[model samples]
Target: MSDTGLHPGLVRPRPQRRRARSRTYSATVRTLGPLALLVLWWAASATGLLTPDVLASPAEVLRAIGELWGNGQLPDALTTSLTRSALGLLIGLAAGLVLGITTGFTRLGDELLDSSIQTLRTIPFLSLVPLFMVWFGINETAKILLIAVATTFPMYVSTSSGVRSTDPELIEAMRSFGMGRLALVREVVLPGALPSLLAGLRLSMTLSVIALIAAEEINATAGIGYLMSQAQSYARTDILAVCILVYGLLGLTADVVVRLLERLLMPWRTPQGATR
Candidate 1:
């Protein structure tokens, strides 16, 4: 043996090797699994095992994509979808983060908001859509409101619970050190709550995207959701499938952005997972 003791380079190399191995496995599994499914789907459609009336083949969807692309409808619809979803998500994140922190940190706030939140959470998300429409009209306001409301609760619950579950010993130590209220929150509580808050935010974003799509689909003049709805009227399943694919892609893109942000915001989080 060249060296019995662990060298500085050797110590780090083990972890680097393990990480690379893990990534290789993860990538292979994810890609191969999806590829297998796609092959099956393509085969089934080609063999007429699946009805084209109900399920468009990938080729058909691609052809429809070309048409949509040529018409310049795809870009316009995508822009509208992104804009509405982003706006709604921004509003919801702000409201939910503030409320969640206040309620989680204070007894008085918990007493005031808990019961109301509990009751409201039980109501179906879809049920609120019509109410939003009536209250705000069938305009961008209604769509945005619908998405924002859908996004709020998940974030509130996650952030509040994360705060509540923070290690009391750490909190006590901070208090013993004479940390002020704002500093305690800014330095301790918020950071402790961040992992959970991120989880809630991720959920909210996915939900908001869905809610916005529903809002647009029900009645709207623009957006991918509108295109999907319009296609259904004409029995254009290929275009409908294309819209669904776009929704999936957009959702994936949004989640990836959030994951990157989480990594930046919580560098302390290990590869193992978020602590909470």
Candidate 2:
């Protein structure tokens, strides 16, 4: 038999070719799945399979978005929501980082706070709505605090886990160099924990967005959630869909931002499944 025909079915591509194919497959699915779903949604809406009052069509949503923009309602709602989320996120991040570091690095701190935090994190943050409403009054403070509360646990947990998982040998080496508490953490611990911190940030931000929506929906008069509530009252599914999509896009944007930050801060870290 000729060499080319002897084992044609047995030929395997090179490793590079395999990786390229894997990446291509991953990208294709990520793109195509959303596109396919969009097409299906459009088809269903057009065929009346999805009732307008229940699920607005993409075109209706677009029109609603345009109308909101023209009337400046969307911009005001967006600003209000973003302001609340931003304030809450900053406060949550600061508290979580401080608490995480204290408990992560000190037995005394851990003994004093870790158990309580772990226990508290078990309860759904949303369950605090009634209590918050009573204490904070259905004001922006309550909504912002709700977002802060929802976001804190993820960051704290991830940071603690990351700190605990740092290499013992590396830590010992740092200690041998007469590294003080501040230097040790600044130089070694924080860098080691960057991945987990960023991961937690992503989760926390996403949760904050969700909590903001819930908080606003309950008693808001000037945010995206309030707009959504009004839309519901008016039976405007298109406006509701627009708000939902905006929330999704904001979450997606946050995730992408965190991923970019991770790449920027951890240049030495290996990309998953890529050859060094």
Candidate 3:
């Protein structure tokens, strides 16, 4: 014992242990806030402070959702809304990535394209809805295009910024090794820009959801927005509440999926204090 080189008291706890403790604490705080809000909501409803015509109680909302689910209405509406959002998001993401990469990587591309994109971006995307409706009609085409346009700007901005911010030193080092343009981009530029690109994806997903909701409200015969419109006309507060909850859940779910994808694709990125 006397020959021991170090004291046990001098040892530090493992980092994973510390991280686990912090994660548990943060999770508790997150749960507590939502739990408190739910309690307040239940209390207000039980006390009859919230009028049925304006706000439905949690129980009423639950029953309404159950009825809709049992009748297959909720599932059908969800499918329509989700399909439009997914298709629009894919189209937007592809276009944005190509344009961003071209402009970020070449002077000629930037000169020819960046100014036009910037000018268009300055004009509010939503303001084009009336024009889109006239051009595409109030059909699925208009709705999908509206969501796509709304989703594109964030991706373009973020990806361009990310690619441009990549280290010149890394580029030089890769060039010194006689790396081809494709290899340099694949190994250096894309890896370095991934974080920003993923952030943009998350933002685009959120905007797509919002734009889809608004687009559907215009003349939708099927989808959650249409359900809400019908519920409003009938003063069906329970159904309205259910629709609101579903919209929120969809947005939250999309954000979570994007974050998970980010973590998977960028495992080398530090994990602490990442935003929602």
Candidate 4:
């Protein structure tokens, strides 16, 4: 017996049951939007409202993907693009970390470097293409440097902001406890700034992918961008569609990787309705 005349056993749904229902509902709602768009796209293509010349149908894109995969072009391009992005990201991350820590931790460093970095950040990356081509001669060096440059600013800004956002009172307390500068930074500043750092990493990864597209356009002999250039020359709408889809997928994958990193690194940030 319970309030409202219900049996104790049925007084309320189990928490697990409620959580499961919530997750299921959320997933269904999330999937519906994309599914509806896909259906509409198929219908338009089927009804001749959308022409293959304008935009290839989803079926044609899928077939094109299979063709590329079977011929080994897709795998080779994917590997090359991934390698370039990874290398550029690593270099950019290292440079950003050093600059961010230097400017964030010391007033002298900030006064000397932050203004210049901020001014450089204001310049659009595309405008650097001509200079990079001239300096690096459209080689792998130019392409990698372009991606590295594109990814660096986001990480620098995020890291600087994150480090500066650390609680001053907590820092003072640690100082009073006889912590050295290196120890204080290692334990107090970095941990507190971890969320921001991870956010920066995520942004950097996304920028790396975007930069990859532009970098590959520099007289590229391989990679998705090269495939896109070839497809454009041959008027292969299906191949163009495949390239666009691959870029979208790469972006999606980067986002997913960051989310997983957040979950793993920030265990305290539990999802709503999670079992904690």
Clashing pairs for predicted structure model 1, backbone only: none
Superposed Cα deviation of residue 204, candidate 1 (Å): 1.0
Candidate 1 vs candidate 3, lDDT winner? 3
Off by over 4 Å in 1: 1-22, 172-178, 268-276
Over 186-214, each residue of candidate 4 has an lDDT whose tens digit, in order, gives: 99998999999998999999999899999
Looking at candidate 4, the ten consecutive residues that score lowest on lDDT are 12-21
- The pairs that clash in candidate 4 are none
Where does model 2 exceed 4 Å of error? 1-17, 21-29, 268-276
lDDT (Cα, tens digit) per residue for candidate 1, span 73-122: 99999999889998988898888888888888888989999789868877
Q: Residue 132 of model 3: what lDDT?
A: 90
Per-residue error at 26 for model 1, in Å? 1.7
Candidate 2 on 1-276: residue-level lDDT in tens?
447665555764556443334556666766897799899999999999999978999999999999999999999999999999999998888888888988998889999999999999999988999999999998889999989999999999999888888898998999998999899889999988988999889999999889888888667889899899899899999999999998998898898888778779987775575532
User: What TM value does model 1 have?
Assistant: 0.85
lDDT by residue for model 3 (78-167), tens: 999999999999989988888888888778989999999999888887788889989999999999988888888899999888889999
**TM-scores of the models, in the order given:** 0.85, 0.88, 0.88, 0.88
Off by over 4 Å in 4: 1-24, 271-276
Better of 3 and 4 by lDDT: 4
